[model samples]
Target: MGAGLAMQTAVNAKLRDFVLSPYLSSGFSFLMAWVFLLLLNLVTRQPLLISGTFITHNPSWLWLGGFFGAIALTGNVVLFQKIGSLQTTVLPIMGQIIMSILIDQFGLFQSPANPLTWAKGIGLVLIVSGVILSLGLFEPRDPLLKAAERHAGKGSQLFYQLFAILAGMLMAMQTAINGYLGTTLHSPIRASFISFTIGVLSLILVNLITHAHFSNIRLALKQGPRYWWIWIGGIIGALYVLCSSWLVPLIGTGQVVVLALFGQLVFSALVENFGLFASQVNRMTRAKIIGLVVMFVGVLTVKFITF
Candidate 1:
């Protein structure tokens, strides 16, 4: 899922000019995935269902995972609700950075070996530091934070911490895998469709075993261009997968990851301050500005410093 987020920027960079209406390509890719998933449902005997009531009452943007710290943590979300927010946030990010360094060092998942350079290593450390500092993850906890952990009932959650860290490592692995698949297929659109289709099947199988139920299925999807931005999430998703696939072939994997993170931080600030695309106004902070600058430098150092 993190790779899914990182890949779109690469897609935008790579395929923006080469393709005829890249978003349209993205749309078709999603459509293909849906068709594949629909077919899978036929053989698998699990209808793609949803909770109609749960979605009907929520703001539409919630579907895009904009709530961030809540669902982004997933399994750790429950743990986060138990432990303080800082530990949960910090562990995964630290874990991801550590794993990405290893992935680059070993050239995992068909990646060309981009052995860790001194500059790259230092930059990654700075990036991690900035992430922790900007989020105040290292700051002292307040009473509310301590109170919130009551559900966890005051015990060492070493297990969830390790689990969260492993999840971050898995994200790094996912990006490499996606990049490899995209390169092999020679089409980001096809690669993304395949990824999405597989994801749908995987989730459906999970739901089938769990015997999950939903209040309703959201069937009122519209493809009109005017309403395009609303469903643009799908386009962005397919586009990112395509971009990552294309980028891995050129820049190796870690640089793609760094550049994508830099891009996300830059644009996310813009969206938050201006309330673009129905996003919330997060008002950038001094620390956040510092963090972005540090991250940008890290990205430049990682990508441009040819050692």
Candidate 2:
């Protein structure tokens, strides 16, 4: 599932190249996922509508999971194009870890409460240190870092970094909210479908407000046969969403998030090192390897180390 999330970022980044607008690319991705989920729900005989009494009883904020998802997905598409896969992956991960900690500690969004502990605190510090190492911050001469500094001014670069972290935070929130929604809806698939439906609507509103060009959609379709892989992004996204919703209920959100983060970190490293999906090649250095090891340890500490 985490690998799918990383691939979704790469695929959507490529899709943005053809679509010429992040909003459109993300909207199309959500649309495809929505359609796929809709079909799956139909085939599986899942109910599309829930009772108004159920709706009235639950908090309205529960429905905003898809809204948060739309922003996070769109933000990832934009960040991947701007910061390369490595930064795009790690920055959001930092935010995700922090947000997941908050959710677990406070029982936010109706998730089970697991208060913060010294081990968890130490784990977070290690994870942050690992992220810094993975980013090659100590090596001032790294090619990717220099390139980013040269291309985007310090102000713009900082903005993108912050945005990436914000996107990750929203993703964590979306997971928790969708988990509760799944419990309420009694079907993870239905929860996924609802999430995608709201995501589509959110993207549509954003596209309309931004006056995004619709012509690019036509161009993408014309070029679709040659770049067939781009279309699979939505399918992958659908699966990731379904898995998260399903897993979060069975396991805790923090566990599911950290496990997914592990998958994302490993797969994204592969994507960066190998230049998969036509992305830029950013070789994994020794520092990055050590950083990954530290992160793995941190994840273990957070998951297994008790009071």
Candidate 3:
């Protein structure tokens, strides 16, 4: 859990750097992650550390899952730049709560549990209300008045918010894919390694086609991007995806996302207000404070109110 928090912090910081494109950060992060995992394997002398069974047994799900993961990463990194970390993170909670209900109740994704009950229903409502409060969606005025107002305007902010929400939905897809993959594939690490590598490669291709910033690439490699801290964001993303894929099967995707949301609330508060590790400290507002509390309550209810 601590490791996941650290990785997420790295991701948020990378987004703030406003550096060599979101795609670049994501791709580079995966490349770096591949290297990081390899290094660990080399140092520990554990060839089995990240097994090959993931590819041998069921290659299709890894590829399919990688596709959604790429989308999720692109949306999340961009949304982080636009909507701020806390707001962006909350969007996933909303999607996961909804998706979990449908998937679990109907066995859409072949979830271990089936047929959602009243407890889950009530928990979902609480989560929805908490998201509204946390996001300040219910407030009449711009909920983020104290925070940096979107330079783009209402339409732009709305677009960014939607991007954040879409990122969440894509992540939910990735969770289901990973859970399915986990069952057939023996090693979680190997499956994660492959999925991230494919996703990262895909992002690179897309980025080169869209932007084709050869000059920026040269500069980033040499001196690093303007905000190099953003690289940590990639590292965080790599670790988070790997671990999340591993954990979600054991616990449901809904539970894992809920836990992650709780972590985001605390980490985002520190990142935005206190500026931990020299990160930007966005202004806090009264509505946001109240919203944070509401989110906490929602998390507690979701965790304990199991049917």
Candidate 4:
């Protein structure tokens, strides 16, 4: 999943340009994802609706989750163009863990203020180290994967890396915000729907003001593409938004970050194993396995360890 993970942000943004205005694309990504999930629940006979009155008449600030998401997604496009995807993924994740620590400690963005502790510190270090190791920071990477880095402008790398870091850190905050919003609504899915709706409206206004690019999107609507996989980003993103919103309040954002990282690391390996989404099949390395083990310990340490 190395390539796929790296490209998803940029590809999602680019896909937006092709399918709709940039901001609409951003907002609409969630819309597509919500629709797909609704269909999935229908097909699986799973219950979809839940209580959601607070979403309609809650804090005005609660509506900003999608706005943050749109900016974060667009920042990734620039990062991919400047620093390549590996750096984009690794640096941002590290930034995310750090920000998770800060957010949890301060209860930033309505998150419950969980005091920072030694065990959490140790776990954070372990998780960060494991991520670095899993990415093969000290080891050689594939020549093909390295090709993207080669084309990157050296002068801009640091700036882009910083952008990636900031974006990653913001991701944690966004999740926390969404979690708070979801709690108000009494349903994560409902909160997700509102966030997407607000985001879609905001982007639409922006697009209309900037370039009035409705024609392009209208054309896309008229002549749909043949490929099925282009819409996959929405599905994956919906899962992230929904799960993070549901899990953050239950587990606290700190544990949610660690657990999410673990899941990402594990699923990345699985995706690579099967070459899902045409990502390069990576042979599992002993080092990566060791890193994963360390990350699991980190998760346990973060969630269960106290003194």
- Residue-pair clashes per prediction, in order, are 7, 0, 4, 0
Q: After superposition, how far is residue 139 of candidate 4 from its true place, in Å?
A: 3.1
lDDT of 3 by residue, 187-265 (tens): 5665566566677778779877878463555554454554555556556666776677668779976577667777777
TM-score of each: 0.57, 0.93, 0.78, 0.69
TM-score, model 4 to reference: 0.69
Clashing pairs in 1: 7-240, 8-240, 10-243, 11-243, 51-215, 52-215, 52-216
Q: Considering summed lDDT, which 10 consecutive residues are worst modelled in model 2?
A: 139-148
- The residue-by-residue lDDT of candidate 4 on 76-103, one tens digit each, is 6555435444444556676676787798
Highest-lDDT candidate: 2
lDDT against the true structure, each candidate: 0.50, 0.88, 0.64, 0.64
State model 1's lDDT: 0.50
Predictions: Cα RMSD each: 13.0, 2.0, 4.4, 5.8
Better of 1 and 4 by TM-score: 4
Of candidate 1, the 10-residue stretch with the lowest lDDT total is 64-73
Spell out the clash pairs found in candidate 3.
7-236, 10-233, 11-233, 14-230
TM-score of 2: 0.93
Off by over 4 Å in 3: 2-18, 39-62, 138-151, 221-228, 241-258, 276-280
Rank all candidate structures by their TM-score, best first, as comma-separated numbers. Answer: 2, 3, 4, 1
lDDT of 1 by residue, 1-307 (tens): 3433433323322222222233333333344445654564456554344367845854453232111211222334243333323334345555667777787799766567778998878777776666656554455667885686565554556667666667566655665565555455454454445556554444454445655432111221322344333333445554555566667779876577666665555654565456444433446567667766775676566556766
